[model samples]
Target: MGGDFGPRVTVPAAIDALRRHPSLRILLVGRQEQIDPLLSHCTSIELDRLAVVHADSVVAMDEKPALALRRRKDSSMYLALQAVADGRAHACVSAGNTGALMVLGRGILQTLPGIDRPAITSAVPTVNGHCYMLDLGANVDCTASHLLQFAIMGSVMVRAVENIDRPRVGLLNIGAEEIKGNEQVRLASRLLAEQKQLNYVGFVEGDGVFSGRADLVVCDGFVGNIALKSSEGLARLISRKLRRSFGLNLYRRLLALLARPVLQELQAQLDPGRRNGASLLGLQGIVVKSHGGANRSCFGYALDQAVSEAQMNVPERISEQLELDLQSRDGSVKTF
Candidate 1:
């Protein structure tokens, strides 16, 4: 992993991962000194299954992806991906520089054929249950056709991971009516509405995200990213307010005793770990992204999500469904 804190942060997360997923084999890629002690922490970790590839380069959170990727040949993120491309590992994941990671991932792993552009997508928890939002921060500026493809990809993803049958898709816009928003959203709405393979639920306002109306929400990366961060911030703010309320006064404290169950449930509802782990969906291999600020529990959840995606063969399923659905419409590529 190309981590900012190197071994100090990764080692503990690694130990927790091993406890949670004994089947998880790690290729620890960092400065040897930084990673060696981490391996030592886990006495139960099978030394044979674990390996290290030394990489001295680390990408800063704000570095230019293209420049860093071009210059940093020995970066840990680069090596982790190389391991996948070389068939040394089945998948690669990083919680480092997201921008750099995206650049290196596409450069090394390449996009799936017929995909307009690989999107950095993640499933977020909805009030009803769970749904996915795509291009969370990958492509901020997207075309009408790109949004259509995102809707298709997001639908396939919800199917593979969440087992949703005929997932309802919504185009993110200023208003619920099809007449609202920019030309891109308007045009994308048309394409999505016409897609016989998709369950297009029509234009959804931003408020509908938490309203649990759509199983898949598609939008330009900038808006989606803003939504993700804003939601996370709101969850935190709400949690703090509840905690403050619980600790306020004598009668309030007595009331808080009665409200404990409700508070706990609300807390769990807002916790990021309970929500779906962020995923780099369009990559060649399954890449589950944890929050950069993830705790050991969150990292563990991400590891579980990765294992589940790998077992489900989500990437292949997505590719298969996409080819069949797109080809069926074009009538060029035969699909079974």
Candidate 2:
């Protein structure tokens, strides 16, 4: 059990997923008593496709990662990931403590060969469609090397998941000029440029993220997290203003009715629930981290993401790409 609503939300989401994908199976890893009650209404077919693995405890949302790693080995989050590592599950999805999940995921699944650490990446809506951005909250402090690694993984992910032939990679910076960013970004820019494997499109500003100027934007978690949150806040502000403007008077209300179809389509296009899962890339196994406050529909989207990643064998693809890149180089690329 994890997240704000725990099994109450996740159980229904899992049931709904089972309904949608006839071949899908789910392992509900949590306290048996808490999880079982939520499943009482599941159909026989849904019950047949789902199993509950008991977890001794639950990790608190605010628990320190290190402490949870050391003391809460039997927590639901840990057990779910362990299932993946043990080959009992193809992927693990969690809406628990992000820090704890990252720590536990890296420790249990291990990083892919040549990857220093796992970076959190997700698809962000762009003018063209969407692009993946990484280091969302995984590595707040990163070296130039780390940024380069993120770029490689993010590019590979987009190519595999989005089916882009050669995705354009951009380094997030204050300006498009090579001379703008600090030492780390500039160095990372040079590294990315040298890699013929990557389609480096030079520096991208904050606004360039949504402009669809690049297929992937690479940065340390500190910058990426702030940018993501700011974008979310701006979206909420614009939505609120639109609603207020539409209800200002009878004339405005009439206008809103006429514009309802267009507004509905726009809302659907920008729904956060449609893109709920954040992939922890570079891990040896698939692990999708869902937002902790997610409702049933949003959690269902996270489950769908996990299924997609598992089917694509994302970890293996990244590993193969990195190996090819390493051998193609003149002994310059780093591996851990």
Which candidate achieves the best lDDT against the true structure? 2
lDDT of 2: 0.91
- Per-residue accuracy of model 2 over 141-245 as CA lDDT, tens digit each: 998989988988889888877778999999999988878999999999988898898999999999999999999999999999999999999999999999999
lDDT per model, in order? Answer: 0.77, 0.91
The candidate scoring highest on TM-score is: 2
Model 1 residue 186 CA deviation (Å) reads 2.0
Provide C-alpha RMSD values for all models, in order: 3.2, 1.8
- Candidate 1 error regions (>4 Å): 1-6, 43-45, 243-261, 331-336
Q: Residues 1-336, candidate 1, lDDT per residue (tens digit)? A: 544444666667766666667687877777787788667746654665578899987777788999877987788888888887787877776778888888888888887766757787776778777777888989989998889778877787787777778999988889987678999999988878877889999987878887888998999999999988998888788878977977889999999999888978877876766653677777777666666766655666766677777767777877887787766678543211
| Clash number by candidate, in order | 0, 0
TM-score of each: 0.88, 0.94
lDDT of 1 at 213: 87
Window of ten residues with lowest summed lDDT in model 1: 327-336
Clashing pairs in 2: none
